[model samples]
Target: MSRELDLKSEKSIEDLKKLSKEELIIKILELEKLRINKNELVNEGKKIKRVFDFTKCQKRHVAFKLLYLGWDYQGFAKQDDTEKTIEHELFHALTKCCLIESRQTSNYHRCGRTDKGVSSFSQVISLTVRSNGNNSKELNYCKMLNRLLPKDIRVIAWSPVIDNFSARFDCTSRTYKYWFPRGNLDIDIMNNAVQHVVGTHDFRNLCKMDVANGVTNFTRRIISANVKLCSNNDQFSKSRGYDMCELTIVGQAFLWHQIRCIVAVLVLIGQHKENECVITNLLNIDNCPRKPQYSLASDLPLNLFYCQFENVNWIIDNESVTEVISTLQHNWASHMIKTTMLGEMLKNIEDLVPDSINKQSDCLLQGVKSKIYQPLMKRPASESLENRIKHYTKKGRLKIENNEKN
Candidate 1:
């Protein structure tokens, strides 16, 4: 078809002067219609994909954030390249189980992009599926997807969000926490420094700017943030145990790597290694965007603590979802027992301590001497880097400082 168009286009402009602009537009529209119909004809599927005659219109759809453990799989969102992501897994489940096809036609929009080895507890997405989905259908969709889904990912709960309930824009806030080991950390000083992150400020210095999509905005509101020596998930551990410490931050959305950048600063301040004004220095009104000097915290330890949706009742559920939860409890008990057995049986397995874990090394004395202090223990993660020059350059422009450089 393109070859035919090339032949037609080869005619001299003077020779083709007979055709008017309106005639050219009509020809183009006609060609576009032909191409669309041809493509549709070629892609016509055999099952529920062709259930609706798209010529008429589309059915109602619903969207939700699909949380997944990206450690073993791919990223959070789906892509054309076909690495297994939460979106891809859900896509397969939708087609094979829920009988929905075509994310492009379905009008799906994910909230954010998370990298490999990252995980989210509250990742949000907008999608339109058959919205008349009743509990029976919903349960069926959940169960069927869970059956095929890898153990790491699960659709814990879903609510019927309003048409105006945008996962990104309408969000009230977003919170993230970076878990760090309790070893030699000055929790009091870190907690005091967290107070500075509460107010609205220039966060360019505290974030590794992501210029990939031309994003240079660095101002974000940090409504509340704090640091604490988190003990454990169980109440008994929280009450009597002195294990598992972490730094938690909650805010109304965040810039790329902002939490981790802030985490590094807090860590420094907590140790009295950096002055308190470091937070205030970055927040200077005259200061512009700048690249983050701190490296990003590990991915696995960071979790998407929660996503705030205004007035969207996220807890709507009945007996079916309850049953699913109960089933999950059962599965977890079984899996835990199996994992315990495996740990004991596979004694040869090398345990590489994560960044936030416990350590017996002389990190305290060494840390005071070395600017780069890495304790010899692994820790957990919460919601979770980059170039030095390019990062600061963009931020400088946003700050309207040193326009002569650019």
Candidate 2:
């Protein structure tokens, strides 16, 4: 009887071994489905409802310093068409961290409304937010928001300010920096040209006239404007196209596309396409009457470098500072590697080609380059600011005050 049982078992094992591969795969898939369903049930049970009562929390008015790489963002301001803005991401992070109930009720104000693709190292925003009931033992706003914010955007620090303080209205000055390569650009001439933009002037001819939005005054004071080599070592080489430089402009305020327009004219001067006196002529609205039709400089290299304020003490956390440094270093390393690779490729190509073939300036300017260069002052002009105001007024988009024309 034992021998007969053994023989039957062996026959069953043989039959199991003869099962089709497809049948085994189907059995495994069925087992995996059961496991997945069991996991889903456990996960569903683990879900918790998040409920925070904002009415019970203490609130404080504060200013936050933000740093962002704006190459991927539409702009710093929010818009109805897209949420791909720095402010949109910021508000999202604030809400996620329960810092504020909503932007509408937050009493929010920004130092500068930076345009599309413009980065900022010192963009500031003042707002009322949920506080921990003690000024000295306040919550870690930077860490909390940084956790929820995108990697490209970071909260550097925050400061408690008076309830009446406003970021936009109270800003003493703003500093903007535009980075560019020194590819065949006459840095000395560019530096000399920028000096003419300093001091108070009606810069209507140097910026887009925003009459529809009720911005009638274009008179702004530029404290200083200059171009300089970005690195000490790079200063030794003027002929090298890869060396970088920057244009730093300090101003009390700026109009739409003002810095970019100024940069476009400076670039033309640097390229020997326009005279340095072009800036002086543009500043004199009587001489220009209307802005000459010209493309603005590329917005990618522009950054809001600083915003000066009075009587504000920024509180920096050691731990958060270390983390920010680490993040910046990683970003720098990644970008540097790509830059070095491109530099090597460029060097290799230059070796194979004539030097005269690459003499053109590489600074990016918006719009197509005309084969036959037209001087900035000689280009076709846009409609005058007065005309723009009148057109908008006729369309019911703007209402000019009695003294606005002056």
Candidate 3:
């Protein structure tokens, strides 16, 4: 290149170097333009290369272990015309990382679809993803995904699985945890009532029937139901009023709003508005043919705690683990500091104001309190599953009649 440039020049290299400053400025501009033009030509030629070729890489079926605080999402699964979902953010990250071309081609399966405002500590999903043929220089799945996903959502671990694994069907049991604040309620009665929920039984009375979606089966087996106090510390000393208590329910599968409905009944039992017999009555479907209408417990504190699958070994990336831990620690510290400041402000207000003036029930901690205690039996009956089916049948028949007349 230097020889060619010297051959084309009017002066030898030594003479050109000794040119005046003005002459040097003109030459430098000419050279820079030439360099830029060459770069543009090279970039234009490179555009012909393919962005990605799926055929060049091998695929592996894997399960991603994830956790998220779902206060801001609609649910775990994707929905039509909505971007506020855990699956939406997950797919965006997966596509950005070139893990899967799109969700349609990924062969994805989620263990459970949690409701809006629900959270998860160990949600799992299995999908086929692009992989290095020999597992050498594999992509860091956890760190790569977490960096692209929202801070509320994190991928904790991943496991390569056999070709035929499905996250939803292969799971033996799923555990859900519901955290609540203990108010003026009886824990012993609530525990006794929860005992009846164990074993296989028809739980139509305890769930919102999705008969409209073609769900006819209401029977679900409960592995266990346990209630325990999580902390003795004064939750209200921090301005939140009740101490933390948790209810863990393990089952093979669940109905829509099943766990939340169960918590509603347990709350009534604890408040002495409903007896332990209410559970048995609800279970005896022949006697209590219809469910009574009652408000479902709040969804914010419910979490998909853990999922147990069959013999799949999980692989952990060490660097991703460190990153996830550090991120969580930083978030926790920020929230803790804010909460402490709020507590101090509340204490000062209480010191100035009379107790009578600030006697609002700690409704935020515990659920909304009933002005009058109504027994479950005395409450208005909710439409039974059979009634819902009948209503839909009639509606369909009416539509057919209208069409025929027209």
Candidate 4:
């Protein structure tokens, strides 16, 4: 009987080999189903799935240093309406890997909340997560998380910290860089204008007032602000609208849309549409009680460059660092190829155009460019801060007390 069964199986294999690809696939699927049913009968009962026991694992509070290309993401913070966000991906990877039970139980805090299309090289987040025995024996966080996270978002490094440390409150400073092409822009005047922004001032007129969110305070300390050429090998004569420059602003904290708003005004100054003192003039709320209506700079070129922290020692995994470098190099090469191709096409087209034609200004600013430019002071303004406060208060978003908003 055993010899006859072996012969029959051999004959079946030979028959399958002669079948077409589709017929073979159908036969394979039928075999798989038969194997599954046979296993179920062999077990005599359904197998119970095991749950991960959090009680048996040790936990540690740590901060993760992250980098992301945010062009495709909604934003850094998660939203109730959409899951296409960095924070959403982070928590998804965490829970999927069983690193933490949930975001609420993880004691999570982000260092900075970047807007949509804004990339970051040094975004940080503090959270409590499952751990191994000790520092030397800890699980490979970068490797584990990177395996599950999308290619654009990466966990570069992590560090253990004190129990009371918060990524948001403990951060000493943040540096933002806005990149733009130097298209007939007066870099000297733009640099001079940015100097006026490098001190403490009431910036309510330069930012969008979020009265409904209870963010009435607009005073923020700027450590530094300037515009400089991003490349060292560039000459003014050879620029031809391809030379890139950056507006760098370092501050302790920033209000919503603050950096973008500042960049828009500085671009106006660079283009000779506004004087350098427009920065200082906007800072004085007594003179300009309402913010002038203006479009913000595009979010694509903005980057969170650095986040300053004190007294925390970051642990760099050599293997993980190597892997991250490799991944970044691959991404850089791909982008560089595309950029070079576009540059070649642009150069070819420029030869056909007349030199007398004026070079176009920055296209990264949001909204349509008007044929007739209006000065910043002459533009229509938003409602006054006091009026916005009153409106939100009437809507029950804020409470007033003793003639002051509480």
Candidate 5:
């Protein structure tokens, strides 16, 4: 059936492709209204209500849970300035696949926002949908969407959910894991240190606070925390070098940069570089208002393990989300294997040295002397120690006491 035209002779019907996004939306609504009337009259066999824009302002919507590896991406949530976020890709599919209206609508809600370079195994999101029967299959929502999205992003599972099944508020808990170089990490010691993070505590100084969100509260509870060493995964003579260490964490919620801070402290204890007393001091509630002195570990090694769901009843269509799950798995597997290979190659530098003529340990340390001080000392090799001290004092950067023998 052709759409009725209201164009003047001056306007060409052939130029519809050049319409602006706003104009195109108006055009789509016009076309959809016509199609629904036609599709329903044939079946109203009169039971189906031929309502125009049934999904618009309607409570009916489909929800989805997705997964992604965030190593090469910016973050889970999208921003106006960046193109690599998970939310950006999600909205692209939503709008392009006709899943929702403009990106500003309340049609979408994700479980949590993982930071840049972080990944998720089971990230949840909810959205509204149009349906025929108590939410029938005629909606064709999942098939239509999977066909349009790229390989890296996938919709692993989805189903009709109650209007109140908010992905953010209704979540039970989240699990995260951190990987480390395995060799020197004392697994037992690290496991013991993790116990300190459990229970309610004020961790204001440990987490990186996002001041923009009005988030002055820096306290969180740890439902469970532990460290484990993977068996049968150790690097051998020919294996890749990345199998050095591993640690996992589970919590109800985490503060911004909280995982990294915890990892830094955990690794310190794992290496036995810091005593348990210092770790306890850091976790003390009275330590409040005291300045933070600990440094955070790197972000590349942390991942969002999984998001937990409750008895709200999820309808996961394995066939619908299979492609999405597989694509992400393949991408992560390939990247990890290659990354491990490169690490192994670097580890072979020790083999290049001769057994008989080993360099002194301080050989590397000597080169680390301050470049500024080296140049000044080189220029006055014969000068007295007292004179060198006097020279730097005159310039006013260093303070030193000279004890000289005549």
Candidate 6:
């Protein structure tokens, strides 16, 4: 299989010059043909392995925990005319692994549907799959799923569940964490501002009201909300320019764009543009009956941190765990190096600029902060949910006063 040329290429230029031009041309052509032949042979030897044949066994309900980076995905749920979704890829892998014949027959249920550009560390799903049968050794679900899934999506753990288990309704609570750079905004003010989010409240003004989609209930219970810095006191350190902070929210359920909307209001308060009374005003449906227009916080930093369930013990495959860890470490190292390189370039560019023309030195907060410091109430408003529902209803695009079911 060795393609070691009969004519050596490492010979000196003097040796090559000794040959006539026609001889050199022929030698070059011969070497190119040999290289192409070697590549074709190598490719011929690398055919895809045959997929595993599923066993004839009983079907069982199971739950699996997964993690994914969502920057390249449209969202966590499948949609028409789009192939770039987490659920779409998951179903594809499940089919490839012969775990489920099809999603329609699997009785599938997801814990929550994350929006585009939002990631998950412990997203869970429950589904029925062909199993190794009762009293038999269980299959390595994590390993089998990961083998067919994309590198960015990995199943870390799985558990056997009762026949009636559903990942969506059986879950008691869900937690989300939003990360952001610690910019020049006032953290204490934001922390104080966000305390209003706890407990049961009518959040019609705090979330994207989907009345047209029949989401008429605006009340939801928040278990807790906390905001904290990742480090003790590194604000003065130049090397640690982009110190991170997170706001974690635990709730029974959340509406569409709820967390992002909350974060946007908190950012407004932190910037001293909006008063803390704005939150109270929004929560009191009597005062602010409809949601005012405001930009949502960026989605890339939001993550579904944990999904809570009861009476289920997860089975971990050690080999799959190791592979998942290695994959994450490789991704982390690559991004870290790129960030460092970009920082160096920015520093060099700033240094080369004259003092008179140079703008302020920067951190990683280029698009994180609001461009204009306007009070939330003073900004131009977009159409409210009530207005949208009326407009659509008048055009016969929606049913009048329809309600969301489950």
Question: What is the per-residue lDDT of model 5 for residues 208-269, given as tens digits with 9 covering 90 to 100?
Answer: 64433345455677788888756434444433223445667777677888877777666656
lDDT of 2: 0.87
Query: What local distance difference test score does each model get?
Result: 0.59, 0.87, 0.82, 0.86, 0.63, 0.81
Q: Which ten contiguous residues of candidate 4 have the minimum total lDDT? A: 397-406
For candidate 2, lDDT tens digit of each residue in 202-260? 98988877787788888888999999889542423424655678999999888888988
- Give a tens-digit lDDT track for model 6, residues 238-313: 4333557789999988888899889888876766778888998889877667677777778888899999999989
Model 5 is weakest, by summed lDDT over 10 consecutive residues, at 358-367
Alpha carbon lDDT of residue 245, candidate 4? Answer: 86
From the highest lDDT down, the ranking of the candidates is 2, 4, 3, 6, 5, 1
Model 6: residues >4 Å from true position, as ranges? 1-56, 134-136, 232-236, 239-241, 346-372, 382-406
In order, what is each prediction's RMSD in angstroms?
Answer: 13.4, 9.7, 10.0, 9.3, 16.4, 12.7
TM-score of each: 0.63, 0.85, 0.80, 0.85, 0.67, 0.78
Per-residue lDDT of 287-401 in model 1, one digit per residue for the tens? 4234423445555566676777766655334553565566668767997798567545433332343333323112322113444653311122211113543665566633322
Question: How well does candidate 2 match the true structure, expressed as C-alpha RMSD?
Answer: 9.7
Off by over 4 Å in 1: 1-58, 79-82, 131-140, 232-242, 285-289, 315-406
After superposition, candidate 5 runs with Cα above 4 Å error: 1-59, 132-142, 234-244, 336-350, 353-406
Worst 10-residue lDDT window for candidate 6 reads: 357-366
lDDT of model 2 at residue 16?
66
